[model samples]
Target chain A: MALMIAVSLPLLAALLCWIRPFRAVAWGITVACLTLSFAAAVFIASRILANGIAIGIPRWFEADGLSILVILLVSFVCTLAAIFAGGYMHHGSQQTARLWWFYCNYNLLAFALIVVPAFASPNLVWVGVELITLFAILLVGFENTPTALEAAWKYAILTLMGAPISLLGFFVLYWAYHMSGGGTLETWQGLYASASTMSPNLLKFSFLLVFVGFGAKVGLAPMHTWLPDAHSQAPTPICAVLSGIKTTVPLYAILRLLSVILASPEARIGNWMVVIGLFSVGIAAFLLLQVRDYKRMFAYSTVEHMGIILTAAGFATSGGEWGAVAQLMNHSITKSLCFYTAGAVLVVLGTRQIREVRGLFRLSPFAGGALLLCSLAIAGAPPFPIFLSEFSILSAGLRSGHNAAVIVLAILIVLAFIAIFLQVNRMLFGNPEPQSTPASVPGSVRTAILIAAAPVVVLGVYIPGPVHSLMTLAAQQLGGH
Target chain B: MASAQTQLIEGLNALDAGLILLTAFAMVATRQVQGVMRFFIVQSVFLAISAFLIGFNRGSIHLLALGVITIGAKAVAIPLVLKRTLPDDLYERREINQVINIPSSLLLALLLAIAAEFLVGPLVSASTDPVVHVNLPIGLAGILIGAYSLVARREAIPQLVGILAMENGAFFAGVAIAPDLPLIAELAIAIDVILIAVVIGVLTRDITRTVGTTEAATMSELKEEPYIWR
Candidate 1:
């Protein structure tokens, strides 16, 4: 019941946003619905912690440890981003009358993100992920500028190309499941439990297709061309949602399927995952140095962080899996904060180019200070959650005897760190451009950033007991020992 | 009598598969936006026919329902949505700029079709079902060819059509391999495909209105500009 309500809240909110009478209050409606949804997600998480799983339906709607963790992260980031949008969009956008459309799409995107993790069946999950891509395409193009529309076009073509490929993959998966007698319902758990009985060849083929197809959506390298454009061009609040959870949502599906493959003894793709993961990291780290747009800089950072998480998961050890789960949570929280701060900077300065702005500290101390804090945290500097999680991942990789990957990953981490600080340092410390006065930051934007920062700041040094257990439980679901 | 009926069904499915691939090739060769859209509709018709044939052969209600949904979504609804949502100028625009010209694109598509055969050859060999053998390779070929056209064609509507063709290809394979898949999934997927059309159509209209062209290749301002660090 909680799951149903949590999922439906956004749909209801979207409906209400479209109603003529509720147009003026769309933002209010969105906030209230999303807040209630977040509470419901919390309730579901508590239930998962108390019991082993939460099942909304016998074979369809259910949440496991990994899923509930993702669900909670999606809901939390979305709620804060929704709050941020109320102010950011109002100030930054020229099309104020269409604000209701933005809220409607935002609610729908949130609903899709939450439900992808909550869905039990893989096929239904595929549909959910497609919905995420389509809705995100609309939101990304919401600005309706030439560049924004171009971004949307590139994003739509690249990501939607993956849809059919992944559909074929899911069909093959269904074939394998049925061939294995399909003794259980074709859910994630069912697939995992029966994986050993299925043909290894079929399992591996399906996994390859899904990985390549969903890889585009996750912004993995080679197919990651659309990501920065979409992230940089979209409204800043949407960027937060895009970077924070949109990418993670598809990666969650791949991981769920990865767990199933791990259950089969004959099917092995861990080394390939490590190589692909490193490739994405290497590409993003290098590109990070050349980014002209601060938003694109953070966008590239999302790719780099996604690589780190994937590489950690590829390590296929319990310790590594724990690190991956931790990094997933930390990155989602911190990246959203980074984009919010970036959005704040954009709002105050009215510029996205790095060279155009100077002395953020002089212009607006709050925006500058927040940017400094988030850049430090996002670069995995000490005493931040990202640093802790990356440390755990590296140490875990070493403990698991993946010495070569560990060394390479470590170097890439340092490179990405330098690249981020290099750009951020140029912005935060220099002299302000002449005649520039700091624009006042909106109260709602400030509130959103402060709330988002609480987790990035607190989780670094001290992870509360419940969150730690949640991470551990999620790692267990990855089928690592 | 039963064996004769089975043979007739099998032959008809093979014929449908051939027509589907031919339409995919025709889509690649077509230059006009409306022409490509027409081929996509034709390809979808063949796809639905194939589904119906398979459903009758297996007595699977799921595949039959899937056939109805396919026709309703792809043949009927998608074109209607595209026409209504998109500007008339989009349909009239011709001379789609090609990354690769027609002959070479067709050759590349043929190569992609062969590659698809090799890619799925082992898996197809593992399954003894004749329908799987026929549908799987052809379906994969449709996907690869569709993807190829997506890259080669730079116009908005053609690119969108390429994606829908790839979807038809996937469902082509799906009906054979997972005929027992729940009716609910088919309905959702069908709706999802139509939604894809509607959303992209709206986006294309916006692009044409704002940018004055639907040539995606012309929108090249967003790529990374090499910055020399100070």
Candidate 2:
């Protein structure tokens, strides 16, 4: 019942947003629902730790260590995004109808994302994740600008193109399950236990298909053409959500599949993951150097971060898994902070071009300072959680005997760091371009920036007890050690 | 082996395979957008007949319904919509350029069909009836050929026809392999095709209005300009 409420509240709030009288009320309801859901996630994680078993909802849903972490992340990030939206929308001149649509879709996306990690059935999990693509398309195109519409269309087509291929993989898995006498058992645990008995060729084929299919969503190299366009074109808050959480949740789904494959005695999926991860990191790092749009530069950084996380997971060691999960959390917080600050910058300067918006320090001090700090954090500067997480991941990769992967990861990270810093420094310290007029900065924008900045700071300085325990438990479920 | 019943089944399968190959060849060779739409209608007719034959042999009521729907929707309704939307001047224009010449494309399509047959033949031969195994490759080949049509055609209507042909090919494969798939899934697939057709109709209208021509090549202006951030 709690799980149902956690999933349904966003959906209900979305419906309520359509009515004019309840528009403001709906924002409150969304925040309240997310807070309650976050509390439930924490409570559930604690209960699982105490009982040494997960909570399951028969064949459809389950809350294990890993899902608990994801649920908490989704609820936490979504709560902040909603708060940011409240202020962000309040100051805008958008119509009630448009605002309502944005809020409704935001909640609907929140609902879908929260449920992805909780599903026990692979089929239903795929359904939920793919459904998020549709919701995102609507939201990414929300502005009705031609560029936004085109990005939405490209995103929709490219992502949906993966669906049939992924479905083929799911069908193969179902075939394997049936052959192993595990029919009607759609749970990941059941499927993994019987994976060894499945045909090796089928397993490899399905793994490749599923990887490429979901890799499109993960914004890995070659298939990542849609990521920059959609991210840069989407509204700033939506950009944060997309860059921070939407991409990570799908990666989590892939991690679950990787866990199953690694546990299988017949097949080794780790090497393939490492190759893809390395390639993604290399491509994204090179592209990051040439990016002109600040939002797109950050989007490429997300691709780089995703690659790092995958590389860490591909190391297939206990420390590697732990570092990967930690990095996932850090990237979510820090990248979101960067986007929040970017949002403030956009509001004040009315431009996304890094070349045009120079000397942000002279424009609005709070926004400029927030952008600088957030850029440093995302660039893996000292005292930032991402810096620690990336270091731990590199160390874990080397400790696990993935020497080549470790070196490649380090090279890519350094290159990406240079590219990001070059662009960020130009924006921060370069001479300000003369403007005919200065845009007014809203106080709410500053508040949103602070709200977004808090998590990155707190997580860097202190890993709260409950969250740390949850991450440790989630790492164990990766079948490491 | 000498039984008339067995001979009839073999004859029907051979005919179905022949039509699949022919439609594939025609799709590659056709120059005019109207010609491609006509070929798609012919392909859909063949698909319905194949489905009807399968229904008779298997005694499945749903397969018969599927056959009727395929014929009524693909052969009749979709073609009518396409014809209505096409400009009259486009109807008379016979100048269409194939990315590859007709003869070469025909040869390529034949080779692809043979390759698909060789690949899928052994897999299905041992499990199910050998007759269904032959149809699998032909169905797959049809899908590939239709995809090629979409790639090669410059006109929007031809591309639409190619998409419809692909759906027909997929339906053939589905019926040949698993005719007993849930009725709801089949219905949903049909509805989705109709929805796609509606969307295409709208896109075609918009393309005509905006560019004054329905040629897809002209639509390339929307291609991603190297991101100039400003």
| Most DockQ-accurate candidate | 1
lDDT of 1 at A201: 96
lDDT of 1 by residue, A133-163 (tens): 9999989999999999999999999999999
- Judged by DockQ cut-offs, the docking class of candidate 2 is incorrect
Cα lDDT of model 1 by residue, B1-230, tens digit: 98799889989999999899899999999998889999999999899999999999999888888888999999999999998999887798587899888999989989998999899999989787888999999999999999998988888999999999999999999999989887888888998999999999999999989999998889999989873332
Whole-model lDDT values for every prediction:
0.91, 0.74
lDDT of 1 at A53: 92
DockQ of each model against the real complex? 0.73, 0.15
Of the true interface contacts, the fraction found in model 2 is 0.00
Predicted model with the maximum lDDT = 1
**DockQ, model 2, C-alpha based:** 0.15
- How do the residues B14-97 of candidate 2 rate in per-residue lDDT, one tens digit apiece? 788688779878888888766776788888888888888777777888788888888878877776665676556665665666
- Per-residue C-alpha lDDT of model 2 across residues A98-131, encoded as one tens digit per residue: 6776787788889889888888777677667776
